[model samples]
Target: MNKRFALLLLVLLPLMACNKQETPAPAATPAAAENAAPAANEPVPADEPAASGETPAPAASAQTPAPEAAPADADAAAAAPPAASGALTPGTDYVEIPNGQPYLPLNGKVEVVEVFGYVCPACAQFQPLVNSWEKKLPANVRFTYVPAAFGGPWITYAKAYYASETLGLVERTHNDLFKAIHIDQTLKGERGQDSVADVAAFYGKYGVDPKQFASTMESFAVNAKLSKAKQWAIRSGLEGTPTIIVNGKYRVLGKTFPDMLRIADALIAQESARPAP
Candidate 1:
């Protein structure tokens, strides 16, 4: 009986040892449990959002429509593949003004100056387009018109513009003057034909006192504006009428009229990112 009991005890003890080897033991301490936890630290890509967090905002596109060469070039532009999104090329698309001229913004707003001439057929063509574009411009931008005073009858036109401004008749006669010269062809812009009297007479029809118009054209204030416009034109490095200067820093250049506005739009976007001067 003793021999049988000993044999059973040996077999049972061996089975208990095997069971203990198969089972897992609890961690000895809290620190050991933490050390056993899995961990990972991955970096987020610059162009991609993080793996676990609030979604990031969409990035601005880097590509823009290339400048159109001419009205007929529209088809060619449409056919070309889009250029990669990036900053605009300097000297090719736009030339930076040599000296960073201080901008005299109105009401603390960024200024966009249009150097145009009344006698310029191109300016006349750009008028309606710009007029519409300016209306839709953000309130933070101030659109200013500076009539080019290039020799010939343009000087007289510039004086006429300032006179209208002085007499508070510019808003009423601005488009009228353009129509009078372009469509109506009644207000001639000849070398000597469109005299100061003729220009003042044109404003007379707009309810401006002819005497006031004539005298205001020669006022010191009018002369100052004309002189300032001449300086602006020269400093802008304009080879033609209808040149646009943004914040007095960049001279916008584009192949088509619409492209000109597009370039301006891009420049405004860049300006919006800058800290206030």
Candidate 2:
């Protein structure tokens, strides 16, 4: 039984995160493509998968795959899930982020930032779990999503995210956008090139004017946010999507998806226990 369990782990371990590589240059865009910078390569977790669509590494045959189709009600999969619980060992479960700081000012709350990319299949798989987890966070804990600025479709998606947030449409379109890219095949994520107009049209289904959406994707405001996101990823020492940083101090290194959240829960508790400054 122990050997069986170990074998199972060997099979599943590599699918936990999307590996970062030398990002391909951004494809031409109708707007602001020139502003998109190539993401710098950083060290990924030893077990992370290779670039999207490539064959899996020799040791692990199954890489992160697009998430299974969500039910008609997307929230149904995440509704009222049990809280994650586990004890954490410093070097085993997580490591401190070197020179790390919160992506935003803490004010009075504990900040949990997820560094993720829309084109990342692992992020798509982790979405439902995080969706439920974020919903249950206490008022004093703030959850923020900072999109990874890995180039190609990654930059395009990051721009779309900032534009949606600016337009007050993120709350409505977040989950569906994941579905569109991974499940419905309506949007090309990492598989093919995407333009500003292509992403704008996806948001159009949610009632925003496509032209305005495309323009906002290139707006100075959105560009500023994208730059900030890129800086945050670098500062966090992020090398892959679906990374959880707790209070900008600890970078989770769990052995499984649930284990990642469990360590994060313990770290959040630890941060909350810290005496006020």
Show the colliding residue pairs in model 1. 62-85, 62-86, 63-85
Each model's backbone clash number? 3, 0
How does each model score on lDDT?
A: 0.62, 0.69
- The deviation in Å at residue 68 for candidate 2 is 41
Q: In candidate 2, which residue pairs clash?
A: none
Candidate 1: misplaced stretches above 4 Å? 1-86
Candidate 1's residue-wise lDDT over 194-245, tens digit each?
A: 8788888888887777888889998999999887776656565555556778
Q: Point out where model 2 deviates above 4 Å.
A: 1-17, 20-86
lDDT of 2 by residue, 1-277 (tens): 2567544543432332365222222342121221122333322211122122222111111234445466567587678555345556556667788778898999989999888877776677567778877888888899999887766677899899999999999999988888888777778776677788889999999999999999999999999999887767656656466788988888876644556777788898989989988
Report the lDDT of model 1 for residue 53: 16
TM-score of each: 0.67, 0.71
